[model samples]
Target chain A: MTTAPGSDRSDGLRLSGISKVLGGRTIVEKMELQVSPGELLCLLGPSGCGKTTTLRMIGGFLNPDAGRLTINGVDHTHSKPERRPTAMVFQNYALWPHMSVAKNIGFGLKVRKLSADKIRQKVDWALDLLGLQHHRETMPARISGGEQQRVALARALVLEPEVLLMDEPLSNLDAKLRVQVRETIREIQQRLGITTVFVTHDQEEALSIADRIAVMNNGRIEQLAAPAELYARPRTTFVAGFIGTMNTLDVGPAGGGVPLDDGALLPCDTFSGAAGDVCWIRPEDLQITEADHAGSVRAVVLRVIPRGHYREVLLQSHGSTLRAFTDGEPDVEQIVGLRATNALVYADDALVQDDEPARPGRAVRAVADSGDRG
Target chain B: MTATDTAPAAPAAPDKPVTPSSGARSPRRWSMLFMASPPVLLVLVFVGIPIVIGIAFTLGYTGGLNSIASMLSVSVYTANGWMPSLAAYGNVLSSERFRSDLGVTIWVTVLTVAIVLVLAWCIALYARLSGGRLGKMLSGIAIIPLFIPVVIGAYAIRQFYLNTGFLVSLGRQFGIQLPSWSYHTPGIVIGQVWVSLPFAVLLISSGLAAVPNALIDAARDAGASLGRSVWSVMVPMTTIPTVIVATFTAVGVMGSFTVPYMIGPTSPNMLGVTLQATFVAYLRPQDAQVIAVVLFVLAAGIGALYVWANARASRSSAVQL
Candidate 1:
């Protein structure tokens, strides 16, 4: 869905069959994506998954070996980074160490040969926008880490780039500052309604900030959906594992159930389609209870790692080890019964639809887009 | 020369002990003084004292160390009751020959520094951006001059640009009359540039290479062209090292004797050759020492510029950190 910024700006980023090969290795496969104006789409993946490569290509820093990249109906596949209406906030911020904060923000305008008054006005506005007015005279190195990051953001935002690209921009910040800055970025992106592509390896970060998350693996997009949609109906095992903690058990038709390590058949004919199918369960969906429940598989609590808001219980099952999230801690070595609810099933590395069909993966075409995500 | 060689570098020495204040008598402070004494003592004895005594001799102190030189000279300006005489300074300063030599020396030093810096920046920027084999080879080849003995290099350069040299002969083949640099001001400039290039390239290239790639990329992304990015970002970032090369090259060229003596014109010469000719050929020892003092003052001006540059760079960088 699109948001309010789409109302004023008609520009959107479109990449069709884009591919990149670096050093004889295909860093990004034939990736296709269309980000609506004013939407913040995250290229979410682990290291070397090509998410950053895709973002770099979109930013015009790197050209796609194949495929066409268009923005606002204009082809810019071979355009230089400056020629394209895109600005990137690099992982390291890339602020000019020699320039003051105001100068750093105004550098793009200065390059455009804008009048001094105009450049200064825009830089001041950017400083106020990022709440960095006091740091105008400060050098990048003299500022604190968070302040440096904001200056980098202001430097990009001052350009009013049509497409905003960030390469792990929050990775340099501490955990506390990371959340704060990401929220700030999200608010700014929404308020401005610029089409933004954020690349990150942190799944939680993607789930927290993105209008849609494109999960990548091995130079290909594994799944592209809203956070809830991805968690609920991950198209592949990789998506399920990458997006959240996934517990998979092999299913077969022998006992019309899933096969555990102990040769016990946990009946799952309702969720799976065929033999060798995988029953994917998110930790929270796996109900581990002290008392035996209907259709429950016997498991032993091996470890309990308290995770602030919830406890993560590692269980030794009949056939394999499985992890389940619980509110209360279960004693190690205590036997428990676990049952899956609303689990996804996959066969041959693909979703095997049995009953719960995925919600239609369609975005609002620049009309209904909002910062809100399911 | 030996003192500069034996002294530890001033900056970023890992074990440089900090001085303890308020008479705390820290072992580290003692170590700092001890480590520092060798260069200080050597410079004071071998370099510093001689310079002072030489300056005194120039000011008409023609006794003890100056006695031997005073006996050999014809018109020695003698001091009165320990009062220094300005007659020797007046004699050297008033000479049209000495004035011409000073002017030529300044011009050559300035020209050499400018050319060397430009060439070094070209090579350094090429290596930094393209990182191609050709740039590296060119940079490596530039350093060969540093290894070659200056006398041999100067002599070879003179031969290559002589009136009947290979370059002149080649121009003759094309029916062109090319002016030779031999026994000319341009010849000294060329020789100085050639000899100074190795250090310039070495420092400047490394300084440029040390600039983070992201800053350049960011500049390019900000709509600056490659040249603009280098001018605005890389140049300012590399001020200290570049200034160091510039100052050192100027000093080296100004005080250089071999290249100027081997290649420059006999008259209207750089002060390096004039100082030699005055003391040895004409036997005007006091006047020559006056010229030496003049040369030192000029070089001290450049050295002061270097110190100011270094201090400003450190101040800015320290604030940044």
Candidate 2:
């Protein structure tokens, strides 16, 4: 496969302006991308965002109506699925019901005309890799869901494909098992240095499992960057809102600052441009303080939710609701102040600036967690 | 069965794991049996009784209900006191005419069932995989015979292949020659396949429909060609319906009367025609009853295969799930 591991320039897999139209609807637009050798890239988007469609095109299951697909620098746009060096783990874990776990893992090898000894050795290796040796001869239907998932994974991995594709492999699992398998998949992908294209709708899963996350919306890639970079520097309003929970306030351009809903000018000093039209504020960055403090907006507490480790106090100021995380059990209707100098300012759906940082001295040290549930 | 007997039967695990209803189970059992009794009783009185009487008559018994057939037939084998005789069986089985007729019956049945299965599987598999106007039209053509009565279909099949009929005349007009096969076993097989195809296709296609597209895609992605995928995955998954089609077609062809009588030749005709000839033409009711018994036993043997296949499919699916 000419797979030079750690070679960032090697074209492990590339989709040059690929597109798909299903039933006369453009499901995936020009999707230009490249997966370097041994890199794991996640297609993160909501349902119907064409993540799975793109993955299928990459795997040769669905041919793109336009553009080309290349694996290892060879054009494979019109190749059949059997001719492509790619394997996919389906969302439902579509293991052959009639075949045992070992046979399923060995199926591709058998199709490749491998000897019996070679097939058995590869199957045994995969079973051990997935920790399914005890259930080697068990049929797919006889095993538990998690075990079936592992079998599906091992079946794909045994082929040693040039590029591995997964279409929401963890979407069928329970929350706890989803986390466990997600880590297992990531660890194996890293250990084997396989170039992978994983598609999932869960943002947290993409953030945790991907080396680089491609946030897609409306059949277009909104942003493609590392997990931390994409989270910190979301280029679009959709990306900012989609990556995490944030408060959005529509503000019009005004002299020296942006105007709020209540006709009060919320001073956005960090915004140097004259076209800032919306305000984005992370709840964690808001310092709970008194209204009389400098650079703080006056507000009234609308509701307080007990988010397991911290309290989420929703404050109303200038006719807009702002959420802030705090430890104190603030009563409803209590007046408070929210200071957010690091508020992400946007203009016409594009990020303008979020240059300033939160002043920790005045900030109420929030637990800095997002997984806690009320 | 009463609730007490149903308890031990329940302990013997079923193909499906039955939930123990514990409290309402006994009353529920009684109601189920009471509701089911009418049909069972009707079958016992009407169908079940006649079969037993017919077998007794074939075994050389000339008593009770057998007295009527023995009195009417030209020759009837009478049983000795307190013992069933095999004279009627030996008398019919040893005859060269009956042996040849039995051979013709089995040959036609096996050939018809095989052709029906191959054609039905092709049409259904094509419709399922390629799914469009052409596949639908092919299925529609196969099902057209279902709408036509067996009498009309058999007559049409025979006439269409005859030397002096429409097809031969058309071939003659084209200055081409073709052999007419009507009044032969091949013609009878053609007629039987045409009549049996609709049932087989409907059943087999329903099974193929249950095979999910995801599994097929998974197979293809695993480097299996279309043929291998169908053989390994689709065939195994649809075992129950396929078994049902085979057994039903075999049973239908073995005992069928209309198609064979209309299309088969006279000398070595299928047992269905031979049985009628022995009973009415030859005035030998005992010999005809013997042929009927043989056909029933053969059909029942095939039926056992269906039952075994069905039970195995259910048990395997249950365990897998």
Backbone clash count, each prediction separately: 9, 1
Candidate 1 stretches greater than 4 Å from native: A1-11, A250-256, A267-275, A291-294, A355-374, B1-28
DockQ of each: 0.57, 0.69
Comparing chain B with the reference, what is the TM-score for each candidate?
0.89, 0.89
User: Could you give the interface RMSD of candidate 1 in angstroms?
Assistant: 1.2
Q: What does DockQ come to for candidate 2?
A: 0.69
| Model 1 chain A weakest 10-residue run by lDDT | A365-374
* Fnat by candidate, in order: 0.73, 0.89
Candidate 1 residue-wise lDDT at B233: 96
Candidate 2 overall Cα lDDT vs. reference? Answer: 0.84
lDDT of 1 at A83: 85
